[model samples]
Target: MKVIVGLGNPGSEYAHTRHNIGFEVIDYLSEQESIRLTKNKFNALFGKGKIGDTDVLLVKPLTYMNASGEAVGPLLHFFKLDTADLLVIQDDMDLPIGKIRLRQKGSAGGHNGIKSVIQHVGTQEFARIKVGIGHPQHTREAVVRYVLQGFQGDDRAAIDAAIERSTSAVKAWLTQPFSQVMNMYNSNK
Candidate 1:
């Protein structure tokens, strides 16, 4: 079975933060499939279902962003799945707002969540979908505060569209070889 993990900090305080965009994608997919993320295991809230013909487990890690590996690594082990069977989705500040990038394997690029995953999973050779949140225009603001802030106005529109696009990418991964999906998705500008 394939696993789709969405990285985000848990708790109501972080609900709509820019850093929680991964959670937003998970919520969208769950809603589309009518699956409730009620099961609590692997330090995550998840639901079992099919994405196209592929059996999948949709997960939202509850270990918060930095400790995401706490959830992902165990789930991989519990499911008897290889690193290749896992897909992680998280926000990225390196691209323009609303952009998405899919890579077969890579360094964390400064994302704590991805770093933790790499540490626990013991490799960077895994799949990940990076949804760009974009850095704040105001350079003076603390990076942490900026990521924790909610999107507003045009930023909101961009992020909303990105989330929809991200959902489409996830669907493609469930059906096609991930390399093919990466080709189709990583080209998005």
Candidate 2:
């Protein structure tokens, strides 16, 4: 089975924030596939269903962003899945808003959630889709505040478009090879 994990903090307060874009994609996919995220396991909300002919598990880590690995690692272990069967969706401050990038494997590049996943999973070799959220000021406090805040006006429109593209990319991954999906989506950026 393929596992698609979207990283985000739990609670209504964080809903729609830039950091929650990953969760947004998972929500969109769930709605589109009629996959109900009714199961709570390994500190995550997840559901099982078919995407095309492929069996898929949609996951939203409830352990928040920084501790995401605590949930993901155990789930993969329970299912006897290798890192190759995982796909993580997350927001990226380094890319411009509305842009999306897919990578077969890489370091976290300062994303604590991805860092946590790498830590617990014990590897950097997993597929990931990053939705750009646009970086704010260089200050640490500014970055924190920016990611946790909701998008506004034009930014919101851009983010919405990005989310749609991200979901499409994810669906494509279910059927296509990771490298092919990366080439198809990354070239659009």
RMSD of 2: 0.8
- Listed per candidate, the RMSD to the true structure in angstroms reads 1.6, 0.8
Candidate 2: 10-residue stretch with minimal lDDT: 180-189
Per-residue lDDT of candidate 1, residues 28-59 (tens digit) = 99999877899999799999998778888899
Q: How far is candidate 1 from the true structure (C-alpha RMSD, Å)?
A: 1.6
lDDT per model, in order?
0.89, 0.94
Q: How would you encode candidate 2's per-residue C-alpha lDDT over 1-189 as one tens digit per residue?
A: 999999899999999999999999999999999999999999999999999998899999999999999999999999999999999999999999989999999999999999999999999999999999999999999999999999999999999999899999998888889899888899944
| Full-model lDDT, candidate 1 | 0.89
Q: Which regions in candidate 1 have their CA more than 4 angstroms from the true location?
A: 137-141
